[model samples]
Target: MKVWILIFVCMFSMPLLVAVLHFRMRKGQTLKIRQDYVKNARYFGRSFSALVEKALPEMKNGMIMLSRQEKVLETDGKQEFVQPEIEDLIIARNTIFCPQQEDLHFQKEIYSEKDALFVKENIRLRAVYSKKRLLFGNKIRLLRWADAEHAVAVYDECDLGERVSSGEQLVIGFENVFHSLYAPVIRLGQRPEEPDRFMEERDPRIFRMPVMNSYEYNRHYIDDDMVTEGGTVPYTIISRGDIKVIEDIILQGDIHSDGAVRIMENASVLGNIFAENDILLEKNATVLGNIFTQGNIIFEEGASAGQPDKIISVVARGTITFYGGNNIYGYVVSEGGGKILKSDREISGEYCFPGEPVHEEKITFRDLSEYENVDFQGFRGDIYVKEAIIPEGASVIPKSQFFECRSLEKVYLPESVSVIEDYAFADCHVLKVWESIEKLSLKSVGISAFENCYALEFVSLPDSLTVIGGAAFAECVSVNKLIFSDTSLLKKIGDHAFRGCRNLKEVYLPDSVEYVGVSAFRDCSSLEQISVSEKIKNQPGIAELEKNCPNARIRFREVNSVEKE
Candidate 1:
C-alpha cells in the first residue's frame, strides 16, 4: 500500500518537474528572428535619405565621429586626433569638407557628410555614399554604385557603372554607358540648370500615344514546349512547357509560361512577361513592359528594358542579376536581392528591331464551305478575314476553327448553329466588328473560344446562351459591358471566362444563372456594377462575383415579369 501511494505521488511529481523545467528554461527569454524587409520598390526611396541621416550618428560599428569643432585639451596637457586609415566613415567637423586624393582606388564603401567630388582622372571607386551631393568628373570609373542625398552629376566621359541613384535630381552630361538610374528628373546629355522637360510638358508636340490597344488578358494556351525560329509573332503566348527562342524574334503581346522563358539574343517583346520559373534575357534583348517572375530574372550583356519616356517594373520573387551593359529605365526589385556581375565586354550580335514585319495575311474570306466538317480550320494561312459566314444548317463550330486570323474583323453565325467548340475563335486580335448574336441558337461556348479578341466591344448575348466556357472572350480589352436578357438561361460562366477584360464596366446577368465559375471576371479593373436578379443573389456562385470584382457594386434587382412569358 505504501509502494502504491509512492507510485501515485511520483506520477504527479514527474509532470510537475517537467513544468518547472520548461518554465525555467523559457524564463526571461523571448524569441528573436531576423526577417528580410519587403516593400513596394516604387515608394521605397521616399524616406531612405532621411533614414540614413538619422541612423548614421547613432551607428556603433567601428564608426568615428569628429563631434567637436576644436581639439579637446585634456588635464595632462595632451591632445590626440584619430586619423584612422579606414575610409568607410568621414564625419565633417563644423561643416568642414574633405575630398579624396587624386587617382586613388577605394576598395571599401565610403561615406561622407560633405560633397563627394571625383574630378581627377582615372579615379576608381567601388561605391560611394554622400549626405549632400555627389559629382563625378571626367575619366572617373565607378565599379559598383553611387548614391547621394541630393543630386548626382556625372561629367561627359565618366563610367557611371551599374547603379547611380539620387534622392533629388540626376544629371548626366554626355554619352556615358550606364546600367540603371533612378531619380525623378534625369537629364541625359542635358543640363540640370536648364528647364525640366520630363515633368513640365503638358502635351508634347513630338510624342503622342498611338491607337490604344492591349492584350494583357490573353493567355494563349499552347499545350507543350515551343521552339521558335527567328521571326515575328504577332500575338500573346501562353505555354504549359518551356519556351525557347532559338534566334532573334519579336512578340507583340504578353507572354506567360508554366516553365521557364528564355528569350534569345536580339529579341524584343512589346508586352508584359510572367513566368512560374526563371526568366532570361540574352544579349541585346528588349522588353517594353513590365516583367515578373516567381523565380529569378537574369539579364545578359547589352540587354535593355523599358522606354526612355516611361518607367516600367521588373519584379522577382528571387534574385535579379545584371552582368553588365544592361539598362533599365525603371524599378529593379527582387525579394532575394539584385547584383551587378562584372563582364569584360558586351556581347555583339545581329539585333532584330520591331520595324520589320510583313503585312497581315490577306484573304477576303467570305465562307467556310471548304473547311473540314464545315469549320474554318482549313484557312490556316494566318489570313486577314474580313467576314466569315457560318453555312446554313451548321450545328456546331469545330475546335480551333478560326485560330489566329491576324486581322479577322467580323464573323456571322447562322441561326442553326448551337455550339462553338474549344479554341474556335481564339487569337482573332481585331475581331470586334460583329454585332449582336440575339437571333442565333448559341447554347454553349467551348473553352477559350473567343480569347484574345482585343478590340471586342459591348456584347449582348442571346437568351439561349446557357454555358460560357472557360476563358471564352478573355482578354477582350474594349469589352466594357456584357448583357443578358431578364429571361435568359445562362446556367454557368466557366472559369476565367471574361478574365483580363480591363475595361469591363458593368454586367447584367439573368435570374436563371445557376453557377458562376471561379475568377470569371478576375482582373476587371474598370468594373463598376454587377446587376443580378434578387431571387438568385444568394445562390452558390452569385455572391462570389463580388470577390472577383472587388470595386464593382452588386446590384440585386427584382426581375420584370414581362420577360418571363
Candidate 2:
C-alpha cells in the first residue's frame, strides 16, 4: 500500500514539470517572431520602402529582392559585378520590373545604391529575358544614352526571349545568385497611337540662335515679316509688315513698313519710312530716314535720327517719347509738348517752326518767342500759325477759313466764331481748347479735328453745335475723361478711328450720334467704361463695341438724361 501511494505522488509531479517546460518554449518563439516584425518595420520606414516598391516596375534588366534578413538586387549579367560602376539608376527605375518571374513581387528599394546597373560599350551584356541572344563587345553606354539624363532611358539595341509574350516569367538573382522569378511584359493587339520607338524626339535645348546680316536689293523689297535664326546676309529692304532687326540689319536704302518696326543693337536703317505701328529703336540704333507711324514711337538712349535742317517728321497716334540722350533732328507733333522726356508727349495736330520777322496773316508777334501773341482780323481766309507760336488776341471769327494748323496748341476761340471747317485743328494738343468760344456762336467741329492730342484732356463743347463729322476724337490717348454736353451735332464716329488710345478711361456718348464706326476703340485697354445713348441699342456698332470691350462697363439711357440734360 505504501509503494502504491509513492507512485501516485510521482505521476502528479511529472505533469507540473512538463507544464513549466512547455510555457518557456512558447515564450521564446513569441519573442523571435516579434523581433523579426519589428526589424522589417524599421527598415521599411528608414528607406521609404513603399515608394521604391511602386517605382520598381519601371526598371528593365534589373530586379530588387527582399528576404527575411536583408534587401538585394541583380543587375545586368557580365563583368566583375562592380556595384559602384552603375549609372542612370532613375532610368532603370522607369524601365525594368523588380520581379519578372515570381507571383510574389519583391518590395522595391529604389534608393538602394546597389539596386542599379548599366553595361558599358565593348562588354558582354546578358539580357534579363534572353538566353540565346548575346550582345557582342561594342562601345555603347546603356541607359545613360537617353536624352533626359535624370529620369528617362532608352537602350540603343537590346534583345529579349522569344517566349516572353504579353505575360511571361523572368528569372531574378540576388548578387548573381538565382533566387526568384516574375512576369512583367504584357503583349497586346495592334496599337495606332503609339509613337515609333525608333524615331528621336526634339529637345528644346538643341535650338541655336539665328545669325542675321544685311543684304541689298535694288528694286525688290521684302514685304512679309522676315524672321531670322542666326545666319548672315547683306543689304535687304523690308517693307509693309513688322521688321525685327534681331541682329545687325543694316540697310543701304530705307526700310519701310505699314506695320511695326523694331531695331535692336548695332542696327541702322538709312532710308525714310511710313509705319502704321510703333517704332522701337533699342540701344545704339540709328535711323537715317524719317519715321512716321500712326502709333507711338520710342527710342532708347544713344539713338540718333535725322538732322536739324533735314529733320524727320514724326507722326504718332498717341505719344512720341524718346530717351533723354536721344537726338531727334526733326519736327515732332504731339497733342502735348516738345522736348518731352521722362514725361508723356502726346501727339496733337501741332507743328513747330522758327520765328519769322513779319507774320503772313493779320495776327503777328513782333518778337518771336516759344509762346507768342496772335492777331486775327482783316483775314478773308482762315488764319494760320506757321509755328507753335501763339499770338495775342487770336480768335476764330464767323466764316473763317482754318484748315490744318499742324503745330497749333492752346488757341482760345473768340465768342464770335461760327462754323469751324473740316480737318481744322486736326491734330492739336490744345490743352484749354474752346475755353472762350460761346455756346451760340460755335456751330461745328470738323471731322478728325481733335484726334491725337496727348495734352488736350478737356474741352467745353458749345450747346449750339449742330453738325460734327466723322472721326472727331478718334485716337485721343491722353483724353482720360470726356463729358459732351452737345449731342445734336455728333452724327458719326469714323472707322478704326480710335484703335490704339490705350489710356482713354471714360467716354460719354449721346443719342445724337446715330452711327458708330468699326473698330473705333479696338485696342483701348484703359477704357474702363463707356455710356451710350438708348437710341444706339440693338445697333450693329453697339453690339460690336460690347463684344470688343467685354471688360468695360456699358450703359444705355435716354439721350436727354445722359448728362443731367
Candidate 3:
C-alpha cells in the first residue's frame, strides 16, 4: 500500500513540478525581437559589434602607436590582400591616414583602440573598426563593413557599401548611398530637420466624445486569403491565410496574418505588418511602421522601408534578401544574415550605384474561391460574449479562431495552453476566461488579445504569466479589478497595455516584474493606486508611467531586491 501511494504521488507531483519549471524557464529567457520593433532596435549594432569582435579576434590584436610616422611605417597600405602579423591595424593620433592610398585599395581589416581613424578621398577598404571615431573623405567606398564606438562622419558622395554602423551618431553628406545603416541618430544631406518633426508640427485633430451606436469595429476577420490591390482601408485586418496587397494603396491600420504577406509594387502602408511566414515587398513599397516576421523577408528594386526622416524597423528571423536599391532607414536585421541580390537581367557581375532591379514574376491579386470575409468595427471592438469553452488538450487558440461565435462567457482552457496569440479573443465583450482550467499554465498573452472589452469587470492573473503584449487590454472601460498572484513571474507589461481603461481602480506589481513599458497603464482615469516594489519603481520606463497616470498614486512597497535571471 505504501509503494502504490508513493507511485501515485510521484506521477501527479512530477507533472506539476515540470509545469512549474517550464513557466520558470520561459520567464527567464528573453526574446531579442517582437512586435515593438522601433523601440528595441537601438541594440542592433552593438549586438553585431560584439559578434564581430568574437569572430575576428585579430581585429582587437592592435596596439597604440607612439607617433603618426610609426603607424604609417607599420603597414604598407598600397597593396591589396597583403598578409601582416596578428596586429595588422594601425592606431595613431588625429591624422589623415589611409592604408590603401596609392591604388585606393585596403584589403585587410583595421581596428583602432585609442586614436581616431581617417581615410583619404576615393579609397576602397575592406573593414574598419574604430574605438574612438571614424571619418571619411569624398567618394570613399567600403567593400565589407565599418563601425565605430563614438561617431562616424562621411563626406560627399561616399558609398557605404554593405553595412556601416555607429552606436552613437552617424552623419552623412550629399548623395551618399548604402545598403544598411544602424544608429541612434542618423543625419543626411545638410538637413537640420529632425525625424518626426513633420508629425509634431501637424495640426492636432479635434476630439469629440463619441456616442455608442455600433457594436462592430469595421476591422475585417477574413477567413480566406484577401487581396488589397488599390483602394483605401481605414481599419485593421486579421487574415487567416496568405494575403496579397498589390498596386498602390494607403492603409491606416495594421495588418496581421497567420500565413505569408506579399506587398506588391508602389504600395504604402501607414501602419505595421506582422506576419507569421515570409514578407515580400515590391519596388517602391513603403511601411511607415514596423515590418517583422519569424520567416525570411525579401525586398524588390527601389523598395524602401521607413522614411528619409522618420525611423522604423525591418526585421526577419530568417534570411533577409535585398534585391538592389532596397533601402531601410532604421533597423534592418536578420538573424540568418542579409543578402543583396543583383537582377538576373544584367549578366555583368559588377555592383552599381542606384542598384539593379529584381527579376520577379508579378502576379495579379487573387481572391480565393472559398472566401468568407467578416468585417467588424466598434468603439472598442465591441463583439459581445458572456461565456465560452475551449476544446480539451488544445495548446493554441489562434487569433480570430472564434470569429462569429457568441453567447460565450467563461472560457474553459486546456492545461496545455501556454500562449494566447495576438487578437485571439479581441473585442469579446464580457468574455470571462480561466475559471474552468484545472491547472493554470498560461505564459504569454499576445498583443491586443483582450482589447476593448468594455464589459469585463475583473481578471485574475496566475503566477505563470510572463508577458502581456502591447495594447492587451486597451480601451476596456469597465475593467474594475485586475488581480495578480503574489508569486507571479510577470516580467514585462508592454506599451499601452491597459491604456484608456477608465474604471480600473488598483494594481499591485509582483517583484518578478522587471519592466513596465511606455504608457502601459495610461489614461486609466479611475485608477486610484498602483503598488509596486522599489526595484520596479526604479526601472527605466517606470518614471514615465506616472506622467501618463496623473491621478494615480504610486505607492512603493518595501521589499528585498529580487534576483534577476
Candidate 4:
C-alpha cells in the first residue's frame, strides 16, 4: 500500500512541475517580444527625427567664450577692450569660441548646462546652485557637477591674480571671466555635439548687434543715385530709406531696407532680403536665399530666387506679381492678389493665392469630338464638357490652367505634352478618367497636379513618366484603380501622393520605381491590396506603406511577371 501511494504522488508531481516550467518559459518569451517591439518603435522614431533634421536648415557650430581680466579701455567718449571681445578662442578639442560682443551681453542666466558645459576631463556642470554673483553680478554660481573624476574646491570672492597664503590646492584654474562688457552673457560652455542641426540656421552675415530704434544707412553713397555700384558688399546692408543696386553687384550678406529695395539686372544676392515696403527684382537678377516684404513684390522676366534643394520662401503682405519667365525654386506666399503673366517659363514650387477664391465658370462644349485637335495654348478659365480630348500637338499645360473645374468629367492628354505644372487641373471634383489619347510623352507632374479630385477613379500613367512631385494626387478620395504601363519609366512618387484616398482598392507599382516619399499613401483606409515587384521589397518607403496600412495585403511578384491589378 505504501509503494502504491508513492508512485501516484510522483506521477502527479511530475506533471505539475512540467506545467509550471512551460508557463515560465512562455511568459519570458512574451516579455522579450514586448521589449523588441518597443525597441523597434524607438528606432523608427529616431529615423523620422533624423529625416526631419535633414530637411531643415543646417545649424551653426562652435562656442563663444570671453577671457578673464580683460578690461575696457575708455577712448574718447567710447570704451574699447584691450583685446576685442569678438576674438575667437579654442576651448577644448573640436570646440571653438567666437563671441559677438554686441549680441553676447545682456544674457541673464544660463539656459542649459548638462549638454552645454564640460569641465576637467570627466566632470560636467549639471545644475546652478545659486544666482549669486562672483564679481558684481558678472559670474554665475554652479551647484552640482556630474561624473566627477576629481575632488572640487569652492571659494568666496577674492582676487585670483594675487597669491593666497592658504595652502588649499586648486584642482582647476579660476578667475572672474567677463563674458561681455555691455550685454549679459547667458550661454556658455562647449558647442552642441551636432551643431549642424538647428532651426533657421543663423545667417553668419547677420550683423549681431544690440537692439536699436533705427539703423544708420551708408552715407558714403548718399549723394549717388544708386546706393551700391558694381562691387561686392561683404556685410549686411541696412538702409533707412529706399536703396537701388543699379550695377551688377554681388552681395555676400542680406539686405534690409525700411523703404523700397530694387535690384537691377545682372545683380545677385547670396543671402536673404527684407524690405518694409516694395521689392523689385529686375531681369536676370538672382537671389540665392529668401525674400520678404511688407508691401508688393515684383519679379521681372528671367529673375530667379531660391535653390532647388533649399526651402527658400518669397512672402509679401501685399500683391506678388511675376512678369513671366521667372524661375523660382521655392514657395511663394501672398496675402493679397498674385498674378503670373502667360509665358513659357516655369515656377517650380508651391504658390498660395489666398486673396479672393475664384469660383469655376464653366463654358459648355457640346460637340467635344470636333475640338479634338484644339490648340490649348492660350486656354484659360473653366470648361464644362462631357468628354474632352486634348490636341496632338499640345506641348504644355500651365499652372492652374483648369483649376477647380468641378464640371469636368473625362479628359484625354496628348502625346506631345511633356510638362504639367503645379495645380494644372487641381480641385476638379467631378473629373473621373484621365487617359492619354496617344502614347504619352509626359515627363513630369508638378505639385498638387490632381489634388482633391474626388471623382477621379482611374489614372493610366504613361511609359515616359519620370517624376510625380509632392502631393500630386493627395485627397483623391474616389480613385479605385491605378495602373502603371508595363514599360513604365516611373521613378518617384512624392509625399502624400495618394493620401486620404479612402476608396482606392488596388495599386500596381512598376519595377522602375526608385523612391516613394513619406506618407505617399497615408490614410487610405480602404486600400486592400498593393502589388509590387520583388525589387522594391527592400525599399525603406515600402515599410512605411505597410506600417500605415496594416490590413492591406502586399503581394510581391517577380520583376518580369508584375501583374496588373
lDDT: the better of candidates 1 and 2 = 1
lDDT of each: 0.63, 0.42, 0.58, 0.51
Better of 3 and 4 by TM-score: 3
Off by over 4 Å in 3: 1-89, 101-127, 131-145, 149-163, 167-181, 184-231, 308-311, 323-326, 340-565
> Candidates sorted by lDDT, descending order?
1, 3, 4, 2
**Candidate 1 Cα errors over 4 Å, as ranges:** 1-377, 380-386, 535-541, 558-565
Over 294-314, each residue of candidate 3 has an lDDT whose tens digit, in order, gives 998887765656543234677
- TM-score against truth, every candidate: 0.35, 0.30, 0.38, 0.34
- Which candidate comes out best when scored by lDDT? 1
Candidate 2 vs 4: which has more lDDT: 4
Model 4 misplaced regions, further than 4 Å: 1-392, 410-412, 435-438, 559-565
- The whole-model C-alpha lDDT of candidate 4 against the native structure comes to 0.51
Candidate 1, TM-score vs. the true structure? 0.35
Q: Residue 296 of model 1: what lDDT?
A: 90
Per-residue CA lDDT of candidate 2, range 1-565, in tens? 9999999998989999899898878732111112114222123223343444554565444533333222335433222333332332221222322222211211222232222223343322222221111111112222111111011111222221111111111111111111111112110110112222210221111111111235433323232234334222224455556766664555434555667878776565655655678788887566655677777777665565642222245555655554533444333444322222332323223211111112233233333331121111112222234332223433332222232333444455546555555545554443335455444366665665555544555533565665554556656666666556544455555555555567777877656777766667766777788888877765655677666777788888775744432
Prediction 2 global C-alpha lDDT:
0.42
lDDT of 3: 0.58
Worst 10 residues of 3 by lDDT: 202-211
- When sorted by TM-score, best at the front, the candidate numbers are 3, 1, 4, 2
